[model samples]
Target: MTNEQKALITATVPVLKENGVLLTKHFYNRMFTHNPELKNMFNMGNQQSGRQQTALAMAVLAYAENIANPSVLIPVVDRIGQKHVSLDIRPEHYIIVGKHLIASIQEVLGDAATPEIVAAWTVAYNQLAGLMAGHETNLYEQQTHKTNGWTGWRPFKVGKKTPESAEITSFYLYPADGGKVAPHQPGQFISIRLFLPQLNLKQARQYSVSSTPGHEYYRISVKREKGANLDTNGMISNQLHDFINENDVVDLTAPAGNFTLAPDIDAPVTLISGGVGITPLLSMLNSLVENDYTHPITWLHGCRDQSVHAFRNQLNDIVKTKDNVKQHVFYNQVTDENREAGVLEGYLDISKVPSLNLQPNAHYFICGPSAFIQKQYHDLVGAGVNKQHIYFEEFGPQLLSLN
Candidate 1:
């Protein structure tokens, strides 16, 4: 974009900060109305809860705020690229979004949107769309080139459904084509699309792969979401829990995510999780154990209690057999037996555990709620852990900026 266009976009940062959600809401509404079929590609649950709008607002505000130096937003771009590829988002979708976005800006800004300003925003949107499309193209190419990999959604049949806890259940998905599946990075997720009869539309949700790679099937442990009154936050999850079953078929995109463990790294590794966020971390931990990683490995988890702690026995067996593996469990409520077994009560507090390896060479991976990840990140940094070595994955949109 030209210097004048950049200046215009920078000047609108305040507007974006204040009214970005309003703009994005308008954009989605307009786009969906014009192209109803495109709704199949989006998470309608998030759309209903306004989470998608809020996430898009933050992204737009961030872009406008850093219009002069977009290179600084490379991390955000890469993260979004991974998600887009997993959803099978293509260049044509970008064109649709760009058109609706420009029209939404013109409609919402009204008289304030001078022709010059609109022209500038159009250029700015095209530039960002171009960058994101290019990045997503590369990701799609890489994913399709992987062993047993293919682009777009592939049919997978639910081979088995096992209850992990009161709230969480594991679904083992096998290729309906009866072929080998591509391996995924330990912390990666796959996009599963299911038809929602209530909305009479298809919706997609990304769930972290909980099982170790190389198996004939990919496993995703899902926590049934019970939304509060009038909330649509867990529509897809509830559908999976209530209706979907073994032998049922669903469409899924290949695994894609940047938050993954490096099996080759010979450093102390720590895996931390809260609530159902343990899914991806469990994959990393299991893969490490399966590969016989020699470095010291630590697992820290926090949840309600024993009844809700998924994979309790499996984790216990690993701790008992692996000398290099150490486990720490924090419960909101504890029993006498838990106290006898070294289970700590209350939330996860790293400071209370001095025996944990805090060396700079150690790599820490955390997956959990946004607040949980933020607190863990700050605590790790405060405890003299290198910031670069601390990585986290948020279940929803990428909102937290630790830097």
Candidate 2:
């Protein structure tokens, strides 16, 4: 809002446009070189995949756009706050990042890096830093004070590994410290941190809690990352599948995420998921069943085959126990003869989605690959679903745009 702030934002626009990628690269390099400890805080694989780079670039642009009207950027700030908390990003780290970032800009701009330019950037950086610091503080405070299943990383030990299919496995996690765990609402995600030996880095990934919140333990179903071929395995997921085992201790950041079940018990709920995207919906369904909510619930899940379908038995059990819950499975590749009889034999046709027992005031939750979510999102919106009522989560870096 200040003239200095306006000047700073104005001066940085051309620089960011011209050398954003280079600045990001240099900034990260400098940051990691100076604070090797931070290497553990970020996803190296995401860095290599160029996801982190793009996210930073986008964030800077967003910040610049909202320089005069920072309030317009609160949602962006809130999301970044959640991510920072999930990653255990602290205020001190911001200072470090800012220093390195300014140095990188100076290194890039050379003689053009006048005192005024540096002062403007300094003010801008301080303003952003204060914003981030406040956001993080509030998040931390909430996590600390909240009684229900919301909190920072808690120690959990693996209880069971139930095989969902060839590529998918479900993990039951119980608190290792014997502390009370908060009950999470359906459709929320928990951030899991793993110290990978091979990569020598602490990597974090968000997994939808597959079980209802009232249970004694948390469950997450993960699909093993089958690389494009033999060349590119999903770094965090594959490592978890291969290395994690029953009784192993894991750290889980509190149940956090905005995607959640509809609060109104009267509103119809439709869950659409693809492959392992079924994790969150399964949790919601279980919650609905446990709480005996009378709202009609339809689960339309798409997978390759029965072999890869997660929670087949559990879903069947729900259909049997809950009159309000219905399930439709689509198998892209069906090999099993007996169980494959009534299963639809292709991907979900988004156009036909609206005809699937949907109610007029239905709320929808969708999770899958970027393409799947995007296609279904368009289809749902096209079918006159209120955009506010539709919630979705994308599996990987491809979903960054949604963030």
The top-ranked prediction according to lDDT is 1
What is the TM-score of candidate 1?
A: 0.96
Every candidate's CA RMSD: 1.5, 2.9
Against the reference, the lDDT scores of all candidates come to: 0.90, 0.77
Output the number of the TM-score-best candidate: 1
Model 1: CA > 4 A from native: 227-233
lDDT by residue (tens digit), candidate 2, 145-182? 76644555788999898888889888889889776667
Residue clash pairs of candidate 1: none
